[model samples]
Target: MKRESKLEFRLTYDDSKEIEAIVCIIPGGAEDMNSYIYIDDYLTRNYKVAVININYHCIGNRPHLGSSFYLDDIDKFILDTSLKAINLKCINVYDINSYENLNNTFIKIDQEIQKLKLNQQLHQNYKLKTHVSFLPFKNEYQN
Candidate 1:
C-alpha cells in the first residue's frame, strides 16, 4: 500500500503462480474493503489472479478513511501500463454473490430446459428476463 497516494488497497496474490491479471474489488456505497474478503479469497484461489480490495471514497466518516483523505480517491492512482489481463473487472465489485446466485439459477433453468426439450431461444429469453428483474431487487434485500 502506498501512503503518499490518496488511493489505498489490500493486495492478495499467489506468488507461486505467474499472475497476469488483477481483480480490483470495489466496496459498496457504505461498505469498506473488509466487506469483500470472501470475494478476494475466492477470486485469487480460483482464478489465479491478483486481488486488490480497494478502499475507495465513502459518503460518511470511516476508520480507514475510505482509501484516503481526498474525495476523488480512485482517479489519483495510476495503473501500470505494462499490465495484461483477459479483462479488467472493475465497478460494482460489491455484489459478486448476486452474480453467483444468478448463475446457479441459470444452471437449474438450463437443466430444466434440456429435460423438457425446450427451445434454446426461449431459454435465453427467460434468462434475460430473470436477470433484468433480479437486478432491481439485489440491493433492496441487502443489509
Candidate 2:
C-alpha cells in the first residue's frame, strides 16, 4: 500500500466509517491497459469501502493477457496479509464485475468480514449460533 511499493492498489473510504477489511480486486484482463484508476474510483465512490485494484503486468505490452497462474500468487498474498477470519466461511465469494450486483455484493462482504473480525477482537467467545465449527475454541458446543 506504500507509494513506492510494487503493491499497486488504489484505496478509498468514507470519513465516517472505519476500515473493517480490504477487498482485493484481481481484475480480469480483457485488454492490456492500466484501467484501474476508473475502476478504483467507481467502486470506492459508490461502496464507501476501502477498495483496492491490484495491478499486474503482462509479459509484453499486451492488454489483459496475464495468466491466472501468476495472478494467483498476488491474490494469495493479499488474502494472507489483509484479511482476518475465525473460519473460512467469513470470506465473501462474489463476481467482481457484475454491475447489477456489485454494490450489494461489496456491502455484504464488508459486513460479513467485519463480523468475523469483531468476533475475533471481542476475545472470540464464539457460540453455536454463529455456526463456525472449525476453530479449536474450548467453548465450542455440540448439539
Candidate 3:
C-alpha cells in the first residue's frame, strides 16, 4: 500500500494595493504531482491580485476520484474569502486539475481582465479596484 503525502503550497500576492481579484488554486491528487503551475509574477505584480495554491495527497494517484475533501475544503475557502472582494462582488475560483489547463486558464483570465478595463497599466499592475476574477472551470469530460 502507498502512503499519503503531506500538504503544502506557495502563495504569492500583493497586499499593498487592493487588486482586482483573488485566485484560489486547489490541486487534486498528490501534493508532489501538482495540477497547477504559475508561470511568473506578471499576473500578481501587474494585476495586483492574490494567488493561493493548496496541495494535498492521498494514498492513490487519483485521490480526487474517491475523495470530496479537496473540493469541499476549497469551497469553504471560497465562501470565507468571498467577502474579501471589496470592489467587485466576490472572488474567482478556478477548479483546475492539470498544469497545462492551469496555464491556459491563467492566460485567458489575465487577458480577459486586461481587456475588461481600458486602463491596463495602473501603478504597475493595478487594474480594477473591484475584486478578484473568479472563474470556475469545470472539465466537461468529468462525470
Candidate 4:
C-alpha cells in the first residue's frame, strides 16, 4: 500500500506592513515537496514573504529519512535564500504535527509580528526626536 501523507500550513504576517512572513508545517512523507511550489508561486505575486519548511517522519517504526538529518540546516538555508529572494524579513515554517494546531499559532504569530513592527517604528521616531532635540545644543556649544 502506498503510504499516505498529510500536511497543514498557516500563512501569517503583520497586516500593517506590506511585507509578510509565512510558516508551513509538513508532517510525514513528501507532501512538502509538492506544496512548496504552490506557495512559491502564491507569494511571488504578493508581499515579500519567506517560507520555512519543516520535515518530520510520522510513519510508524520507519528509519529516519536521509533528508531528516539536516532538517535544521536546510530550513535555515531556505529561510536565508527566501529572505534574499523576497527582500523581506518575514519568515514562516511548520512541523508536520503542528499542522493540526496551526490556527491558533498563526493568529499568535501574526500579533507578535505586528507588535514588533510597531515597536520598531516607535523606536525610529524616538531616535529622530532625540536627534532633533540635540541639534540646537550642539550648535550652541560650537559657537
Candidate 5:
C-alpha cells in the first residue's frame, strides 16, 4: 500500500491587494510538500492570503476512482476559496483552473458587486414606501 500525504499548495499576494492561490495535484502520487512551503513564504510576505490542497489517488490504488470525476469538486473548491478571499478584502482570487470560464465568473461576480453597491447607495439616499391605488368599479350593481 502507498502512503497517504498532504497536497502541495501556494498562495501569493501583490501590492495591489490581489490574492493568488494554487494547488498542485500530482496524479498517481501523494501531495507535494513544497507547495505548502511556498505558500507559507508568500503569506508571510503578503497579508490576507489563503492556500490549500487536495490529494488525488492513483487508479485502482485507493477508494476513489480517478481524477476526471473530481472536476466538479475542484471547481467548487476554487469558487469557495475565491469567495473566502473576497470576503477577506482581497481584490482577486487566482486558481489553477482559472483559465476555464473564469472570465464569465468574474463578470457575474462584478455585476453582483455593482448591484450591491447600487442598492446601498439607494438605501442611503432614498426612502421606500408601499401604496395601494384602485380605480372606481363600473356601475354594474346599479344597472
Candidate 6:
C-alpha cells in the first residue's frame, strides 16, 4: 500500500543574525521529531545555525510492509526536497546517527553537535560556486 507523504519539519533558528548553517535532525525507528529536542535546542541556542527537524518517511511506524524502516526512493525525494528549500550557501550538517537503527545512539547527537560547533571556522567562509549548463532551472517543478 502507498500512502501520501509530505515534508513535515520544524525549523528553529535565532534571528539575531543571518543563519550561518542548517542542521538537520533525522530520528530513527518509531521515534518522532520530538525525540530529538535535545539536539535541536543545542544547535540553535548555542550556535548561529538553523535547525530543521525532519519527520522523515515511516517515522512513528505509521504503516509499512517491511519489518523495519527501509530507505525508499520516496524517502530520498522527501529529504532532497526538504533541504532544497534553503537557498543560502551555508554548510548543511545531517545528523543521521539515528536514521535506521532500532536501537540508535542518543548521546552521539550531543557529541556530533559539539564536534561540528568546534569546526565552524573551517566552513564559515566557504562559498558555493554554481555553473549553469543551460539557463536556470524552471521553478514549475515545485509542488
RMSD of each: 19.6, 21.1, 20.9, 25.5, 25.2, 21.5
- Which scores greater on lDDT, model 1 or model 6? 6
For lDDT, the strongest prediction is: 6
Span of 10 residues, lowest total lDDT, candidate 4: 128-137
Q: Using Cα atoms with residue i matched to residue i, what is each candidate's TM-score against the true structure?
A: 0.37, 0.30, 0.29, 0.22, 0.21, 0.39
Candidate 4 positional error at 97, Å: 32
lDDT per model vs. reference: 0.48, 0.44, 0.46, 0.39, 0.40, 0.51
Ranking by TM-score: 6, 1, 2, 3, 4, 5
The digit string of per-residue lDDT tens for model 1 on 4-118 reads: 3355589998888789898878887667787788888888888869998986542224434322222122211211111112122232222324445535544654565454345
Please state the error at residue 55 of candidate 5 in Å.
30
The lDDT of model 4 is 0.39
Candidate 2 structure quality by residue, lDDT tens digits, 80-122: 3444443445444323333334346446655766676676743
Model 6: per-residue lDDT, tens digit, 1-143? 34355557998888885888988888786567887888888888889899999876545343332223333345434443443443222322233322343124223333443554467732444332322111111111111
Candidate 1's displacement at residue 22, Å, is: 0.8
Global fold similarity of model 1 (TM-score)? 0.37
- Give the runs in model 5 whose Cα sits over 4 Å from its true position: 1-100, 121-143
Give the winner by TM-score: 6
Better of 1 and 4 by TM-score: 1
Clashing pairs in 6: none
lDDT of 4 at 55: 38
Q: What is the lDDT of candidate 3?
A: 0.46
- Clashes in each model (backbone N, CA, C under 3 Å)? 0, 4, 9, 9, 0, 0
| C-alpha positional error of residue 84 in candidate 5 after TM-score superposition, expressed in Å | 6.9
Stretches of candidate 1 off by over 4 Å are 1-6, 59-143
